[model samples]
Target: MRTAKFWMGTLLAGALALGYGCGSDANKDPTPQDVPQQQVPDAGADAGVVLTLTDAQIARVLQVANEGEVMLGQYAAPLATDQAVIDFNNQMVTEHTAVKQRLDALLAAEGITPEDSPLSLQLQAEVQQLMDVLQGPNAPAAGAALDLALLSAQLNAHARTAFIGDSLLTPQATNTALQQELASERQAVQTHINEASDLQSVIVLPPVEP
Candidate 1:
C-alpha cells in the first residue's frame, strides 16, 4: 500500500521535474490531451449509479485532491508574472496544504488509513496529463501564456474536485466529521473555480484577426 505521503511526494517531484527541471518551450500554448473524467449523474436523473467506494477510498480521494492542487499551485507560482496569478497560486498552496493536513489529522484520529481506489488512481492520471501539457513541447511560455495555462487547469481541476466530493466521496463517507469536512472543501473548490475563471478571462488573449 503506497502511503499518501509517498503518493504526494512522488507526484510533486515528477511535476516539478516535468514543468521546471526540463527547459520550457516558449511561445507555445499548452494543449493538454483530453483525459477521462469522473462521470457524475445529472440532477433529476435516476439514482442508478452505484458507488462501492469505502471510507478509506474517500480519504484517499481527499488526500490525492488536496495534494494535486498544492502541486499545481507550486509548479505554476514561480513561472507566473501577473500579480493575480501569483496571488491565486499562493491561495491554492495555502488552502490546500491546510486542508490536507487537517484531513491527515482526522484520519489518524479515526484510525483510518487511506486506501487508493480506481477513482483516486484516475485522478492521479488526470493530474499527470495536465502536467504533461504544461511541460510538453507545447508548454506555455512564462507570462500571460503561463497564467492562462495555470488558470485553465485550475478551473477544470476544481470542477472535477467538486463533482467527486459531492457525488462520490461525501455520499460515501460514513463519518459525520468527514462528511462535514467534505462539504466545506466542496465549497472551497467552487470558490476556486470562480477565481480561476475570472483569472482566465483576464489573462486569455483576445481572438486574433482573420
Candidate 2:
C-alpha cells in the first residue's frame, strides 16, 4: 500500500532523472526489442486484438492516468453551481479517481512503481494551462460562460485520454488485467467526450450588454 505521496515522488524523480521531455523520442515507434507480443483471445470475429506492453510502458501509462485524474478532480472542484455541470464533473471525478486507484493497486501488486514519461509531462503542462485559464482574472463568472469553459477543457482532456488509452497505451499493454483496464479507460474517455460535446451544444451563453 504505497501512499499517493510516495507514488508522486517516485514518478517525478524518475521523470527528472530520465529527462523524459528532453528529446523528440516520444513519437518514435517502439523498437523491435521494445515491442511486446500480441495475444489473441478467443471470442470469434468480434474479438478485438489484444496487444502486449513492456513494464516500462505500463508504468508510463499509469503515471499519465494518475496525473490526469488528479488534475481533472482539482479543476472540477470549484465549478459545482449548475446541477448539470456538477453532475458531469462528479462523474468524471469518480471515474478517474477509480482509475488511478486501480492502476496504483496493480503497480503495487506487481512490485512496480510508476515513472513519468513525455506524455505524462505534456498532460501536466496542459492541465496547468487550463487551471490558469480557469483561475485567472479573465475567467467567466459562473453560469453558461463557466460551463462552456469547463466543458471545452474537458473535451480536450478526454480527447487526449482517449487517444492515449487507445493508441499509446492499449496496444502496448501485455497483462490481461491491464489490457482490460485500458479498454475500460478508453470507453470511459469516449463517454466523457460525448457528454462534454452534448453539454457544449446546449449551453446558452449570456449576451453582451451594448
Clashing pairs in 2: 52-172, 52-173, 53-172, 53-173, 53-174
Residue 96 in candidate 2 has what lDDT?
A: 78
lDDT (10s digit) by residue, model 2, range 90-132 = 7777777887878778777776656655445555666676666
lDDT of 1 by residue, 31-142 (tens): 3431212232232332343446778888999999999999989987887888989899889999999999999999999888998876688688777777767777666667
Steric collisions counted per model = 0, 5
> Candidate 2 regions off by >4 Å?
1-54, 204-210
TM-score for each predicted model, relative to the true structure: 0.73, 0.65
Q: Best candidate, TM-score-wise?
A: 1
User: How many residue pairs in model 1 have overlapping backbones?
Assistant: 0
Q: Which candidate is the best by lDDT?
A: 1
